[model samples]
Target: MAVDQGTFRRAVARFATGVCVVTSLEGRADHAMTVNSFTSVSLEPLLVLFCVEKEARFYDAVIDSGVWGVSILNPDQRPAASWLSNRGRPLVGQLDRIPHHRGPETGVALLDGAVATMECRTTAVHEAGDHDIVIGEVVGAAVPASGPADEAGALLWHRGAYSRI
Candidate 1:
């Protein structure tokens, strides 16, 4: 039986998660989207996972490139996340509006406002529900906001709105 939409929505929404913008380069164009489904799977081998909607325009890019950059959005970058999440919004001229640095490996745009960024290579992919779970091994990562020796920062999503902890 199908679960009620409202019930499922509320139930899942109860578990808050940090938001991120996963990005990759498609030829000369850059694509990115807001994702709250990012999670840490392991640390020994440096692994993490995030989901992509099956039909999203950037799906093929992620598959074809085999590499992706995940930027954990700081509280100030919420507007960028909301904007990029809107597909088919004429992104040709909006690239300059985003403050970013290109990843040396994939050349994907890494937002500067993020507290941390992870560059991952696709290790495994699986289908679940209507999304594809893309698991990656973190090959390189940087936490400039926290300094070379710091590992702490203000986290943005808590239970709906942005919260610092």
Candidate 2:
């Protein structure tokens, strides 16, 4: 028997996952959304994937742009993560309140203080149930010159709320 959506979601919530902000550009406007579904797909091809609900506004922007940026959030960036995840947020100037710089490869906003950032070009898109899995080829990436410190943990999702570990 197929499990109900609620049961499936609740079960998955028990597994912790890191959070990331995926950004894309539509004309001069920037689009972003907080997602915990980002993952490294392959090392040989330098590929990564992030899942976005088909109806989300950022979905179309990323699909049309064909390029995007991923900012892996640090523990201190929880506020930015929460803000970007909100629905019905203003489309324009959304990144103004958050400190960011445009990625050299994709021109998408990459949040300041991120543990790591990647600029990627869409390699393939596959429809998954209610969401689309966007696989990208990593064109560029950055991390702090000193690298991530051991004590500086990542922002994570657990049991429907943000956590640090």
The model with the greatest lDDT is 2
| Per-residue lDDT of 81 in model 2 | 98
Query: Residue by residue across 50-152, what tens digits does model 1's lDDT show?
Result: 9999999879989888889999877667788778877886756445788999877767788886788988899999999889999999887888745521343
Model 1 lDDT at residue 126: 96
* Cα TM-score of candidate 2: 0.96
- Model 1 scores a C-alpha lDDT of 0.81
Model 2: colliding residue pairs: none
Error of 1 at 97 (Å): 1.0
Kindly provide the TM-score of model 1 when superposed on the true structure, using C-alpha atoms: 0.86
Error of 1 at 57 (Å): 0.8
For each predicted model, how many residue pairs clash, with residues at least 3 apart or on different chains? 0, 0
Q: Whole-model lDDT for model 2 versus the true structure?
A: 0.94
Alpha-carbon local distance difference test for all models: 0.81, 0.94
Tens digits of per-residue lDDT, candidate 2, 62-141, equal 99999999999999999999999999999988998999999998799999889899999999999999999999999999
